[model samples]
Target: MNLIKRLAGLLAVAASCSAVAAPLLSEGFNDVAALPADGWAFINNSSPPGSTGWFQGNPAFFAAADGPAGSYVAANFNNAAFGGAVSNWLLTPELLLVNGESLNFSLRLLGEGLLDRVEVYVSSAGASTNVGADFSLLAAFESPAGTGWLDRRLALSGLAAPASGRYAFRYVVDDTSLNGNYVGIDSVSVNAIPEPGTVALVFLGALALVAPRRLRQSRGLWLLAGGLAAGTAAAQAGPDGLMRFPHVQVVSQPAAPAAPGPGGFMAYKDPVTGQLTGPNPEQAALLTAAARAPTPLLRQTPPAPRPAHGGISLMLDERQARYAVVRKAPDGSVHESCEPAPGGLK
Candidate 1:
């Protein structure tokens, strides 16, 4: 399937299941001055540098693609009003990019007959300001271009992203006063998404010939923080510190005994209070639930500090400890059992 179809399907499933894809960074340029606070960088490399850099977009030229004229960001030849070469740059905040990501933005050029140039660039050097050292042109639009707003997409589908990098808009001209004019940029965004092939595979894998309600409740793929699952899931930080995984629920749990372990680390509990503790709340809940098990459990130990993408295989999904609910019927009957879900999708 195409990206749109697959993305739509993924979103539909993600409404209930955990989702992973989302915008990595977005800049509307609504507040030009606030860019510095948000980590946006501006540099003027014009030969014998010009006095002006990027400023507010002019309403007389055109309104933004999505907001007021002031909402867009613009640059002009005013950098060298008297006449000098110009090579000004406006850079996005630092980003941790990866494969299967895309940069999206809208561009507009003023001065129909005059010399105009706007170029998009990417720098693998994270915070390096030396334009000459590590900048590669991604896209460039020269004079005699269309007068209306131009929407553009630059996919990083081929080159793998570096550890750190940045996208930049470079306004250049041989002679600013004569060749350069005005340009506006708006609706800038960088979206992080799964590879199309992977999305398609997941969408296809989720297909099962089952009842409509059951199908809606069952997905073959479920995403959690930094990982994926179908039968069980990892956990994330929440207000209650509870681990909410698809197809399972933790109803009740016990607090585990606490004491110091090897290397002065608490053993599955807080040393100070002897209360249940964990790498996170969800893990803590799982430790407590395991402690309450009828059979002796594994030697409980304090979780070591996890690195990025590090995961713990801790989950509590059972009738006796977490999921079972006891009910006393109106007719003097009692029942307790785990509710079975269709194919463990939800």
Candidate 2:
């Protein structure tokens, strides 16, 4: 019996070992200065009056870095000298990558003044097709507000094209304002996501550990079966179940109650009984009545208030044109004191 218990424990351990692991695809762009001649291309999309793409006339801008990590391009869009609008550049290939699964990369916009946006596109291959024109936009990322450089990440899971063959990924800068904007993209890799068949192996490994044992005659075989059963049982019991072998009972700890405290000028209490009181309501009301009551009419003048430009717009969509008002914070920061606003995107 003791031997069987040990076998069951082993089985449970095996089950846990089976699980899908996210992996890297392919990477590029460490040397933006010398872009690969064949597989890549870029073009500027700046407005007529503004500078298109980077100053050197290419869509991507190059820069020098500090380590064996070598150097890479600093993806900047804001050209202050040109009305803060820079080129909306794109990089693509002639072939369609239908089965392409993941596009993994890193971005750092090391300052508060910087704002960055990344857009991805996909399309099926066709003769005489303008690959860029036929491409369908997939994912777009906008940098969050802050001072120090931010390490940004995005997982390309649902962005795969429906058909196989020719496919491409494009990066664009949609912002046209110069606020010390600078961005760095590296380890730019694209690889296929794991096939369903590969994922099955992970599950099978886990199953082997926790499954029931067979009653085959050989003692070794029985022991192997028992270990798997035990492992399976242990996992099903959850973390607290580990104690089951020792005949221990589990107990849950209860949470403590909240303490009372004063808030704002108004006193608060349980709505059932108005036991809470702070300011004298009667006295305050009498004072207000006296002040408001009509008196020998006195002339009065009103002063003007300062102007402010603070409003939020949530533009959530593909074309990236129209915007919906998801949250309105007249005071700036989001107002969630009430029920939470629906999904936050703009």
User: Scored by CA lDDT, what does every candidate get?
Assistant: 0.61, 0.40
RMSD of 1: 32.1
| Residue lDDT tens for model 1, 1-346 | 2533544455457433333446878888889989989989998777767667898787887888778767999888876646787778898988876654678888777756666667677776777766665666565565534356767776663344335788888786666555677888999998765443344345445442221244333332223211333322333323332234554555643422221111111134556888752233223224433543598669988876754433333234542222345667789998765544434423
The C-alpha RMSD in Å for every predicted model, in order, reads 32.1, 23.9
After superposition, which runs of candidate 1 have C-alpha atoms over 4 Å from their true positions? 1-21, 160-162, 195-346
State the displacement of the C-alpha of residue 297, model 2, in Å, after optimal TM-score superposition: 32
Worst 10 residues of 2 by lDDT: 256-265
Across 1-346, the per-residue lDDT of candidate 2 in tens digits comes to: 5644654465455443322223433444545545646445555444433432332222333232322243444445443234443434444344334232444455444435454444444445442234335554444444434322223233233324444332333333333444335555555554543443333344345445544565453356445545544543443222321112223354644422211211012333435776753223223224323543578877686544432423343334543433223345678765432222355333
Give lDDT for model 2: 0.40
